[model samples]
Target: MDEHDRTRTPVAGRVEADDRPAPLPRRITVGIIVNPKHSATLRAYADLVPQLQKAGAHYRSMTTSVERSGRWQAEQLIDWGADTVIILGGDGTIRAAAPVLAEAGTLTSLVPTGTANVLSRHIGLRSCRHAIDHCVRTVASIIRDVPTNLRGIPVNAAEFRRADGSRHRTEFISLAGIGGDARAIAHHHFATGLLGYTWGAARALFVVNFTASTGATVGAGDTSGTEGSASGQVWSVMASKVARPAGPIAVFPQARIDAEAFTVVTVGPIPDRLIARCRAWAGIATACLQGRPQAHPLMDYRCTTDMWVSVESPVPAQLDGDLIGDCLELRVSAGEKKLLVSAPTT
Candidate 1:
């Protein structure tokens, strides 16, 4: 789309002045990657380009289609000399572009324009315009003042090898799952479009036997090494970096952005009772909203750097929010890589 097609009327909201002192010099080059499949991609482009131009920053924009891989497009933008890359899409879109940005070792910004904006929620950025403005201003000020040590949190990237011997890499700012959760994701994918997550949750209810095999080992540790135990009849396994996955799902309530390790939540086999499941769901919801430090009998939380998950039979697995088919052996640990991201100041 042309400049006219990309421009939109700025929301008539007041721009709050930053409390930090102004910088002396300001010059920046910004690139935007838009996922056309996202519901809010068009609106995000319209709302952000004008703000970038008005701020006197050089900008480039590209739209992502199924034919064109998000990672390839992001790499092209970085090669085109983007000091900072801004992405407009959901968690999946971000996952696609993250490794590319991280490989380039560039500071990346995000505009939450997808169904599950988990990363955006974690960084406290509410909208596309908010993220764009924050990125532009931060870059400009960095050029002017050399004293600011403002930096983005580094996050772990995960790689999932499918039962078919194919591997896919994804970045998860929220949570990843295997077993019942993976099956739920697959069901969700088949049942609905972007809104399939609701259907997935419903499917989880009718299905009592979601795990392919209960006897398996779930390993977890840090860059130091992996440590954990084996459990039989695994229900749901979640590894999270942030507190809330999306909405009210707080599987890891004590997770922090700057923590040296990640938290794993594994649900062991239990009686398939509605009341028990409801209680577990309630605990997750309450922890997410109230920041309470409580644990459920079905759920166990452990902190570690590396983890190995082996199932008795082939089970569905997912990285970030994307399904990775089925797998008998899954090894997940903090990869020796990191992503640079922009976050709002507290």
Candidate 2:
């Protein structure tokens, strides 16, 4: 409630870092949102309630499976005098609640329970991927104090409206692109788990590589009839917000989570004459694997405040690590939202 009551937490053992801490509210009315399907999330919720009570906090918990997207639930808690929100799920759950929480002016704590807790690592919370007990205990043990705000990465969120007259909004934390990355995300399945993602990436890489080797040209295009625009044969382009994604492959090391500008890594300008698609894709792949994107001429990584990309084809756009249906053009720029976060203690 006051400067003297603010607590501190060390975060070096974790992968990422946090800048400052927020004072814990005196009343401590907490709103907790969980996803019941994740057994780890359930276990963490059980442990979290006791911890909050022992700390003299009043809390209410709800599962996303029963409450849809948790958007309305978050608003309800805000109306009920809850100043802090604890989300017990993976990246998607946290991301889904982000825009709402930002507008509600509530501080949020993340207990990683899903498959790749990418943003958690940046905020001093690291949960082992798919490890239930370890993750559950980790989530419960880290609510030491009210956390501070996190500088949100900018994203060009695309609206994908379906024929059923329904609309879905998705968040892109790290990278979004066309070509192999998008194709691989489209092929991924939730039931198959991590294996599905690995296979999808592998298949995408090899398929692109083989197609290049045979001198096959994959359809690529840029926009015209708008201001001054330079055109290149675009094979693939990734707009990066963070230095690393879910894995070790640093596709956009130049990108920072809190950077004012995001990086756009493009690979292309394929030869008009017959040439190996394998060679171009391989060069892009190598840069990704080594974390040094400028290693090849075919790959170009640039930082910009805004960009416009016209694919000119109907293809699923990969936002963050998943596909977000079909779209034509992309408008990339800095977002207006700022999300407050409570980073876990060291």
Candidate 3:
């Protein structure tokens, strides 16, 4: 038999052959979590509603605000019987909804409408249009199929507790960090998109005290895998499950979403001179962007399942693009649960 004939499945002795598979018997219900601040997202949603309607799909959408969180909206959707969730924002939005959906085993998707859409881009949802188109197709399927835009995107969960005895645990689907980068997020919270991030980074460069160093400890487990300690003049420390957090820079080149352990990159203890520090920062960034790993006294990289970092003074911290305020100590470990997402497999 030919390729087409062999692939066809007979139903009631009748063969139905087509390039595209028929829609599943049961319809999918989609839950859209939108960031109302973006006009482009609103426009995309407007176009999406009619397409979903034409496709005979059932959907419920809500706007996220400073008061109403994505996690709350996701819970509401789940309560409303939604099995599939679509986030129309960036990493921060995804992180907020992740815990609830992962526990419920809900399939999540993203439209990448916020700043530094690192996770969204890594999963092949490059543009808003691409993400929206995938949503239309997703609502037509009932079962999870590998041939379509469905994937199990792995993410690390972190639990952090402060030295002051206040305990708070949160899940992050993207990069998490302490020091200058986190301070930058706090400074740029008033702005949006790349411009905001740039402004924040610039402001942080001048305002942050780079001469300070923090004590860091990392390990894959209680006693197994890699273990190390560092103390010196420190700049910033970050951890991630992806090769790159934003743009072309592979901050953790050896890392992967599906990997069992995440990679941590530490850059610090450089010359106290501002110009010298700037040169080092630019050089390290350039190397990362080129996907090259080099050995330098000012930089350290390691793969670990758990990391503990503490400083003499509290520094700002951020996870998945959301600031976590000032923290003197942070402990992060890999989570056991893996979230399912609608995206191309890496």
Candidate 4:
């Protein structure tokens, strides 16, 4: 038998003869979550919903504002009997619905609507209408032979308690930082509308400084795995699900989605020379774009299941893409895999 024949299974989860093709559904129900604040996202959905309907698929959308809408969206989608969940926002939006979808054992699709669709790019999904069309076709093909045991990867979701006794939850789909990157994100959040992140990153480059007294202990695979030592005061502690760290940055290229663990990349105290810091950033960017792991003086990469971070003083923490408040003691652990749809390999 050929490879395709070997992999063939009936849509109803039964093994059938090679000559018999599994029946495809006439109408597949999909639940969509949209970011109301993003105009581009609204446009994408306006185009996509009509296309899906024309293709004989039913699309249900939940429009949301900045308020916490992910959990409610997931509940509604499941209640609507959606076969799959489609997220039309950025990493933060995706991260918001991931745990719920994962627990429901439903497949999740990304539309790359946010400003920095970093996770979408990392998974080999291009950012545009063409990519959306490709994703739709792929989902159609898989409907018949829906894998019984869908694979999910572990991700760390951090909970932060503020000094005022209030708690907030942040999910990190890519990388989460506690110092420099955190400050950059915070600055970007508050800056003027135009070129906010760019300006914030630039300001962070000049203002952020680190010393040798701060450090973090990372636990990989089982949280109890071998503990690694710190070289200098950890200016930032990054826990990433994807190999690429975030944005135009890529610190650990060896990390893979299917890897049984997460990559913990730590940077020593801030470098003395500005040029060295720039070089480090450049190195990481190169690694991410090229899909290769590169070594640099300021960074150390390792795989772990659990990580315990201790900072000399409280500092900001971020997950996925949003910034939580300051944390003096932080514990990170790997969670179960969440279902994600990706482009089919040719």
Which pairs of residues have clashing backbones in candidate 1? Answer: 25-144, 214-232, 214-233, 219-307, 221-304, 221-305, 221-306, 222-305, 222-306
Instruction: Give the TM-score comparing model 2 with the true structure, all chains together.
Output: 0.72
Judged by lDDT, which candidate is best?
A: 3
Off by over 4 Å in 2: 1-25, 128-172, 206-228, 269-282, 344-346
Write the residue-wise lDDT of candidate 4 on 226-328 in tens digits: 4655534655777677755445545566667656566776765565588987776677556556655446555667777656565555677777657777666
Q: How do these models rank on lDDT, best leading? A: 3, 1, 4, 2
lDDT for each of the candidates?
Answer: 0.68, 0.61, 0.74, 0.66
Q: List runs of model 4 lying over 4 Å from the truth.
A: 1-25, 142-151, 161-170, 190-194, 210-226, 229-232, 247-249, 272-294
Best by TM-score: 3
Query: Cα lDDT of model 2 overall?
Result: 0.61
lDDT of 1: 0.68
Better of 2 and 3 by lDDT: 3
Clashing pairs in 3: 233-269
Q: Which regions in candidate 3 have their CA more than 4 angstroms from the true location? A: 1-25, 143-149, 161-165, 207-227
Please provide TM-scores, in order, for all candidate models, with all chains considered together: 0.79, 0.72, 0.84, 0.78
Q: What is the lDDT of candidate 3?
A: 0.74
TM-score of 4: 0.78
